[model samples]
Target: MATSVLVLGAGFGGMELATVLSDELDEAEVTLIDKGDSFVFGYSKLDVMFGREPAAAVKLPYAEFTKPGVTPLREEVTQIDPEAKRVVTDSGEHEGDHLVVALGADYDFDATPGLAEVDSEFYSVAGAEKMAAAIPEFSQGRAVIGVCGAPFKCPPAPSEAALLLNDDLISRGVRDDCEITFLMPLPSPVPPSPETSEALLAEFADRDIHFVPGARIA
Candidate 1:
């Protein structure tokens, strides 16, 4: 009998795992599930946020994941019954010999007060689109890009936002009239890599972006 596997989520880890399993177990049936209709990568997300890439370009369709032994299902998994070896979704219940949970990380904007209400280009795709649309309208003044909290999904995204915002200002011919500030709780712009840190610092200095290093926003 062929082994039945159910993989939840279509994120980075999940998608890779599913593909590998399908390749390894030629006779096995693998089902990939996620609540989201499409997959948007972390780096590609920034492009959409900056209005450099259209939303459609960033969305990876599930239909394109058709492999010999892999089945892609679009359904919201509501609950998991470990003992019973079954999963329940809006579509129906699925029984599996093996189950992998890979729902990915969710954004908690409400963790900090005033964040959910504030205009943030980093949180949601819709939020990014909204900010992108609003950017061209603002002719002058301060464009404060702030990130509150640590261990966020994408670490370099804030710095990228700062750089992109600076580029946007310059392109609009109002860079001199506007000030871009990066608010984060890091000692360096990029925490993991020293080279990235130095490069980011130099970029910040060159672009005249105010860096609030080690500063926590309350």
Candidate 2:
């Protein structure tokens, strides 16, 4: 019998795993499962928020994904048994010789009270669209780009949001009327690399974006 592999989550990790397995083992059976029918790039949320592309255009269907021995299954994974090497999804249960769990991080809005009541966020496709619509009406105010919690998805997103908002405000001729602040729990943006962190700090200074380090939203 061919080697059976179960790959959960259709994000970058899962997709790559399926592809590599298919390429290496001709007789392998690879099943890639994800709740979402289409995969949206993390950066694509920024694109939509900035009005660079519509939300409808950024969605890439898993059904269109093609690989030799890999099959994409659109289903929500509800349970996993590591000992048994089995996964139960909304559709059915799957058992494989090898199981890979690559489900990406999810937004935990409930962790902080009043977070879901906020006007907008750029973390998700729908949130980005809501922001794009709200931008035109935001002529003047203190725009705070912040991370609600540590270890959230996309470390650089707050920086990206700040810069993009600054550009947008400037383009609308209201930058001087607005104040943009970026808040994160990390000591500095991009903490792993000193050079990149310094560059980002310099950029923030140049753009007049106040960087509030060691600050976590609750």
Candidate 3:
């Protein structure tokens, strides 16, 4: 009998792993389960949030993932039992010969105070869309983007959001009235690579984007 595998999460990593396993292991049973009905890539989230692209354009329907030996289950996993090799999801209980947990990191807005209160054009798609909807209404206002912690998803995204906001204001002929700034805890835009950091610094300077480094705003 073939091994029955239950893969948790439908993110990029999990999807890739399951696809590879299904291709390599012919007789094995692989099930990819996620709570979300649609799959959206990381970058696509930004695209929709900034109003550069529509939500439907970024959404990939779960039903479209038709591959051999791969079953996509749209359900939220409630609990896991390692000893029994079983997982309980909103759909039902599943016993797998093998289990792969590729669930991505969950964002905790509570990580920083005033984050939820303030307008975050970063983080999640819904947040971005909210900002996008607000952007068109703002004829002149300070649009500040802040990063509260390390190990964030899409490190360059916050900066990108600032730049995009700058662009949007410029396109709307309100660049002169709009003030865009980026706040980060790092000493540079991208501290991992100095050259990249320097380049980003130059770009920010050129774009007139105020860069606040090594400072965590309250």
For TM-score, the strongest prediction is 2
What is the Cα root-mean-square deviation between model 2 and the actual structure?
A: 1.2
Error of 2 at 88 (Å): 1.6
Ranking by lDDT: 2, 1, 3
Candidate 3 TM-score to native: 0.93
Q: Score each candidate by Cα lDDT.
A: 0.84, 0.90, 0.83
| Superposition error at 177 for model 2 (Å) | 1.0
> Over 4 Å off in model 2, which ranges?
none
* Per-residue lDDT of 21 in model 3: 86
Q: Distance (Å) between predicted and true CA of 89, model 3?
A: 1.1
The collision pairs in model 3 are none
Give the range of the ten consecutive residues with the poorest summed lDDT in model 2: 149-158
Off by over 4 Å in 3: none
Candidate 1 clash total? 0
Q: Tens digit of lDDT per residue, candidate 1, span 1-218?
A: 88998898988888999888978886869899988877777877668777788878888898888777888899999999988779999999998899999988787777878877776655677777787678778779998777677877777888888998898889989999998888888788879898998999998999999998887676
